[model samples]
Target: MKLKTIIVEDEVLGQKALAGILKDFCPETIDLADITGTVSGAVESILKLKPQLVFLDIKLGPNTMGAFDILKSLPRIDFSIVFTTSSELPENILKALNKYGAKKYLLKPMDIDEVVDAVDCVIAECGHDGTLLNIDQIKNIVQEASQQHVTKKVSVPVKSGIEFYPIDEIIMLRSGLNNTYLFHTDGMTIKSSKNLKFFEKQIIPEGFIKVSRSYIINPTHVYKYSKEDGGTIFLTNGCTASLSGKYADVFFKMLNSST
Candidate 1:
């Protein structure tokens, strides 16, 4: 099915890059609707065209409000989103996007294979049944984004579905061979599809500290710290995680600053 799609990017080059990909690779699946750069123009075009999918960029020139403003101004979100972002974009914004129902994200400079994969997924997801946010949820997302709110919950994508964990309920996270394991206060460990670095980016602002490459611990659950055995973090859950020398200085600095 050819999806009526729009590209909402500030940079002329970004707009052309994705547009070129669609025109060249995905001509059968994507019907290029329109491209808008400014927040006002995006809002106007989206309202007029009513596209099924939108390729949205996080930054719009000097407008720090970014894509969230365009979303907020819209009447409703009936279309699915494929967020286009750079590596430099903050993780909190990434969290916000996921929190509000964005499932597809593409990092720039865009790869052809990844772009194609995202479009195929969008057609499948949006074609059958997909998550779309309402105006109220959009407002909350924008508010959090603007205020730079530290999230209280972390969403972990699992094999079955997404799992939501209260930040306080988490004891520590350990990196496994393929995925990350999350230890909670309930004595259950949930496995997340994302890596240690993914969780670190999302939860570090919420007081979860990466004590080692293998582990990230919630300081609120710290029972004690022992300098013995190289270094180790003792948690209230009666679990101990090894602290690596690599992150020891930063961890120590955090402890010192909190005092």
Candidate 2:
């Protein structure tokens, strides 16, 4: 399966540098999919890329609303978000948030291995049919996402031997005519730069539901599920997806049983 990837860095060097590293590191199934330098571009690329993984810079633009605000607004994005910044590690400001017991705190750069390891956990969690997201409820959800939300590593085959990523942690798949992207939500998003749908099937049975023709959401982290007229589905995250009249009943039934 191709692991689709994207980059959302405002810096010219950062974008080129990361893409260069990915090309050199995981060449077999990973491909450099898309690039965006602004908020509007980030949002558009996210919807269009549906990437399984994304490399996002924390701060962008004069407003400095920050890159995380992009994901925060689209939490259902479920894309593994890997933060890119000059900072060596998570700041004290975020470390403090850990006290709240929610993994909502953002990840700061540490090392390439740290990222590879996180992706590995995502792959491992993808193997389950049911997800702890619903089983654990609110408290558990917050805690899991915070510190222990690890996705097991899987070797994405290449001459480089293996590029490991937690296949299960992947939350969404973004696609393009010739490329794809994967987005994960476990503190960071890992990028592969390949055919995302191929990996999508691996985790589909594990709470990952296709909400739109292009968007696939992980049921594990989904908090809202409202069925609207004309077969549209509204998520707790405020994102709307199609539940075509033909599939609405089955979709709700499945979500109901899981809940």
Candidate 3:
């Protein structure tokens, strides 16, 4: 099925470029529904047309009517979105976009092949009922993409300089009074002055799970889960961490989804 698509961009050149790319490369998969520059117009068009896909620009207009605002104003998000932006987005915004079921995040001066790939990925994953994507499917897609994007390394700030850790070598994180301790697979531990929340926002995208208020673990290194001991998780590196009952349900849910 051809996805009913809309472009919400203010720049004339950007609009032309994106539309041209879709026409040239993704003609069979996408049907251009409409194009609008403002958040209000985009929201109205989406509400009226109920298009299956949207190419949304971050800066629709002033502060009150940004792309995020349009999403927040909607009663329900039944359509998928591909965020088109010129600037590199902040981590918080990226997390929000992923949470809001964005199908893809495209940087401007867009590449035709990337556009085609995004369209193809969306088309291949959509439901047969003509619903392009639901929240769960989008979350899975975003999570997978995030894992791929963060596979190689993670940069951590240290007192002397920055330290880079191979993502696979990391075992888990333990929260401290005002800092967080990172345990590695190679019998090394590093303490960063940043809090658990900081590391959570940074590395959770890389498949780390917060099993409790003070512990975030790499499921890849999980040796065993001991339910008899109030849900203690033992790592492959002979380290143990407690999984709180309060967060157990969501932790298991995420674990199941990943598997």
**Top of the candidates by lDDT:** 1
On a 0 to 100 scale, what is the lDDT of residue 18 in model 3?
A: 96
Per-residue CA lDDT of model 1 for 1-259, tens digit only, reads 8999999888888899999998999989999989988899989998899898889887788876668888888778888788886533455676788776675777667778768988888777775665567789888877776688454677787999667777789999999987999999989999988777767656787777888889999887888889999998899989999989898987888778877
**Candidate 1: worst 10 consecutive residues by lDDT?**
85-94
In candidate 1, stretches whose alpha carbon ends up further than 4 angstroms from where it belongs are: 1-4, 9-28, 31-37, 44-51, 57-68, 72-79, 83-118, 125-151
Query: What is the Cα-based lDDT of residue 132 in candidate 3?
Result: 38
Per-candidate local distance difference test? 0.82, 0.53, 0.78
Which of candidates 2 and 3 is the stronger one according to lDDT?
3
Off by more than 4 A, model 2: 88-259
Ranking of candidates on TM-score, top first: 1, 3, 2
Greater lDDT among 1 and 3 belongs to 1
Q: What tens-digit string does per-residue lDDT give for candidate 3 at 1-259?
A: 7999999999899999999999888888899989999888988999999998899998865652277667756666787789987654555456667667676878667767768877877787677434334445545544554455443555565667547677678899998988888999889999887677766655677778889999999988888788877889989989999999898987788668767
TM-score of 1: 0.66
Q: Judge candidate 2 against the unseen true structure and give its global Cα lDDT, from 0 to 1.
A: 0.53
TM-score of candidate 2 versus the correct structure, residues matched by position: 0.41
